[model samples]
Target: MTPPSPATSAPTPTLLWIDASAGIAGDMLLGALVDAGAALDDLQSAVDAVIPGSVRLAAHGVTRAGLRATKVEVEVLVDDPPHRTWTTIRDLLVAADLAEPVRARALAAFARLAEAEGRVHGIPPEDVHFHEVGALDAIADVVGSCAGVEALGVTDAVVSPIALGSGTVTAHHGVLPVPAPAALELSRGWDVLAGGRGELATPTGLALATSLAGACGPLPALRPDRTGIGAGTRDTPGRANVVRVVLGTPTRGTTDAPVVVPADAGPGGTPERAVVLETNVDDLDPRVWPDVLERLLAAGAWDAWLTPIVMKKGRPAHTLHVLCGPEQATALGAVVLAHTSTLGLRVTSVVRDVLDRAWVAVEVDGGTVRVKVGHRAGRVVQATPEFGDVAALAADRGVPVRQVLAQAQAAATAAGVVQGAPWDPVDGGPAPA
Candidate 1:
């Protein structure tokens, strides 16, 4: 059996955009994924169904500015184009039924663009009209990324230091300087390297990427599971000439480790390289727990969970546990007090040894379930299907979810989808797959 199943640790996707040394665009990003051999047809179909108004979605193999790549574009094929506003675009996308978090991310990305356009034209976000980025193709790029992340089973999206490049680029608005105003605004709060000898980062790449990344820092260590490249239209002599996505898990002690990395050791050793803050309280009203938890997470605690225990004289008390990286201790502490009855908190750090991880799509119980694959070197140590997906599939198939799950386990093993993986038992994990 596989050492363990990752059905337990499914990660939110991480995106890494490799500056092509040339530049990138919406279609180029889509094409690079297709060219690099990612399953994108399903994603394209979802985008078509959701986009309101009329838009035709298609992908083709082509070269941009002398770079060989695939270009995904939406054709309006109308006599006149539609002029859209911030609210108009947001409402339309929201109606399309995109995931809630994805919708928020897209809006934030677009907002940054609008803010940049306004600054260049000297207007406000509400008044600014982002004509180019507000278009259908741009929406596809943003939405498609969410879909692509799901399709690829990517858990962690990390990015390298950006290379902004050199020179001026002319656009519909005017001949602006390299990097553009909107691109500059989107890249704020992140480490960026400019003058890569040519115009490197594009407004579309910067805006879409930064918004989704959520947090900006150095490239984290990952054991790549899938590698997909999104190419730009141009080709230069030396650069990779594409935005490459390396899908994998974040583990301990790798060449790609974080500057102030998170340790993977069990709780005791885990605190070594991480922030450990604890507190005890028995007098606080129970009504305030939720706010305290939220404050801690927002402040920087990677996680916070409370445990009930008996203190001196058997007085009922709760022990608060907060674990995070070194960077978050101060903010996390302030948040704990502002929301809880704890007059004080204890803090410390220690070393952690975490298992290396990745993800794979295993066909279990007649449906495709996302199985997280943890690894060390090249060995796949464990794999498991996420119960949520299995539950939904079971509900749809009109059968006992457990039966479907067991079948999927058998199928995955037989099909060699997850070799040497121990199948999770129905009684323990979930009745569903």
Candidate 2:
């Protein structure tokens, strides 16, 4: 079917420009949204949907680097908040009664955090357990930020080039560099810099900004509506350690649709460097292959797979392949050597072009399934429902998995996530503006 032309009457999407030049954190962004006129009640209700009275949101006026701003604190109501895995949190969000946009944004943020943490520590994304990031306060910050943006009627977001910091800081994994591995990993493909001393941009903050905004660069042209400043924990000398959120409408003759663009890409696309490690083994136990692949993934390998091949003696064997980043080549190579029976391996450097991707949630039979959407040049090219979610929903509802898949695809299409559809991640269409 032919697609409809851009509606002349369709209102321009409200643009949310995140100014993180000073740096950002979950609290800082949340506070900025509140200071910019996000309803406190709406933020509270959204947090309560998933965590259920676990945290309280409070905002107050403050000064940072001699600049007055707002600081929102997430107070934990319970003693010793439990650490949650990505799976546990994802399930909680899927079952919660949240606005589609809020839920989708939160889920996407947490998902990015999980992937970054997993790669940093060498574990499967779902199996990676959280420490500080899984706490009640962080959860509140993520949920609150998402809800606050929706409350302000934001339809699209554009984040400034991030301000990563210098020096060293300690985390759940012990003392790490200023930016932290997870933070750096999350900011991959986006513009970033060492903005100051100490750890400025945090994992939670980077995840929220990267996942929600998609577009990264200097502020685009827009007629400003409201500007809010969010204060960080420390009022450092010589700089305002804060994040500023600018809410506005697109200027005339300009489109407000935001698409994920790689910071280092050329006109068509950019090629990224990666290493492929491969080895053929005929004597290893077949049962051990699965464990070997799992270990490789845990060792920061992007992917691991096995192919059937016959050796010189016509013996049936498996050829294992591991793909990883260049920086991870040594560590992943060691993992490959230790797990497999092969004494040697073939290593090749390769370049790959990647499309921009994001996640959105759709409801099927009252259950939520996340759909992974891929975009290029500001238009959606592909949309696919996560089969794991589809199967789980099918099992819970006592329905065939295929039926759930069909429903999810249909829902995604109806929500405007199909190929050639205009880019808008929020379900039920863009927030009323």
Residue ranges of candidate 2 with Cα displaced over 4 Å: 1-8, 132-134, 252-433
Off by over 4 Å in 1: 1-21, 36-38, 62-68, 132-134, 195-198, 214-219, 235-240, 254-433
lDDT of each: 0.59, 0.79
TM-score of 2: 0.58
Best by lDDT: 2
The residue-by-residue lDDT of candidate 2 on 283-380, one tens digit each, is 99999999888767754467999999999978999999988655345445545554567877898977766655677778788888888776655567
Q: List the lowest-lDDT window of 10 residues for candidate 2.
A: 1-10
- In model 2, the Cα lDDT at residue 245 comes to 90
